[model samples]
Target: MTVEVGSPAPDFTLKNQDGQEISLGDFKGQKAVLLVFYPFAFSGICTGELCSVRDDLSSFQNDDVQVLAISCDPVESIRAWARQEGYEFPLLSDFWPHGAVGESYGVFSSDLGFSFRGTFLIDKDGIVQFLERNGPGDARDQQGWRDALQDLAA
Candidate 1:
């Protein structure tokens, strides 16, 4: 039930690791956003996935594109995790509303009480350029994201 490509992305305001509010609309007409919704922080798969992004961020580091990682963890936990993981990108907290943003993207899992692996590439126009979701316990194919970004940057 992820967002369809070419459709308008749903806007939302959520707190980042520093507790500062970040709204999806803030990037409109500025940069394309890579909105990543994961299940938790400090977990093995989650750690590895984010680390990959951290280690090779130049691929998505241009002024025209920004990466935002969102999780159901609280701001405090996300802050600590970001520090520990050396994630220079914004890690948003979807905790207060308990996955409200994830729910809007159709990635929230009520039973697991967290968001699944929903990854979206939103263009500067606030349109969804790419949308895909992996089931719980399934590792995402990072190359797929890179390929999409390549297509967008073309």
Candidate 2:
């Protein structure tokens, strides 16, 4: 089952593109987390969606908010993609366990060997405040995310 809003988010530790360990709990009591799970690093829809986030990074990442994008791709692939796209935010790799974190969030597709587009907004208290999932090929509207962040701020 998918993780629901109002439930405690499942904490995880994964390597970022730089190979640095990043844990969900590290942001606890500091900033709200926008956890984004994408299917692949260089795929078209994923790139577009993340490019939008990169373009409006300040809105998604700031003192009170942090965006962490995860994919089942290897850290090397994600590192190249981040470098090529000039993304300032962390692009995490869930490749070692092959979508373990995605599975925990109920977004992983075992048959497809990747995750669908799943976005979760987790507050500093570790409670999920907003959740949205889109199937493969379905583009997400980031306005909803902005609205959720605004609500959290309020």
Question: Model-by-model lDDT, in order?
Answer: 0.92, 0.96
Instruction: Output the number of the TM-score-best candidate.
Output: 2
**TM-score of every prediction relative to native:** 0.97, 0.98
lDDT of 2 by residue, 6-71 (tens): 999999999999999999999999999999999998999999999999999998999999999999
TM-score, structure 2 vs. true: 0.98
Off-target runs (Cα >4 Å) in candidate 1 are none
Error of 2 at 120 (Å): 0.3
The Cα error of candidate 2 at residue 54, in Å, is 0.6
Once all C-alphas are superposed, what RMSD does model 2 give against the true structure? 0.7
Over 4 Å off, model 2: none
Candidate 2 overall lDDT versus native: 0.96
Best by lDDT: 2
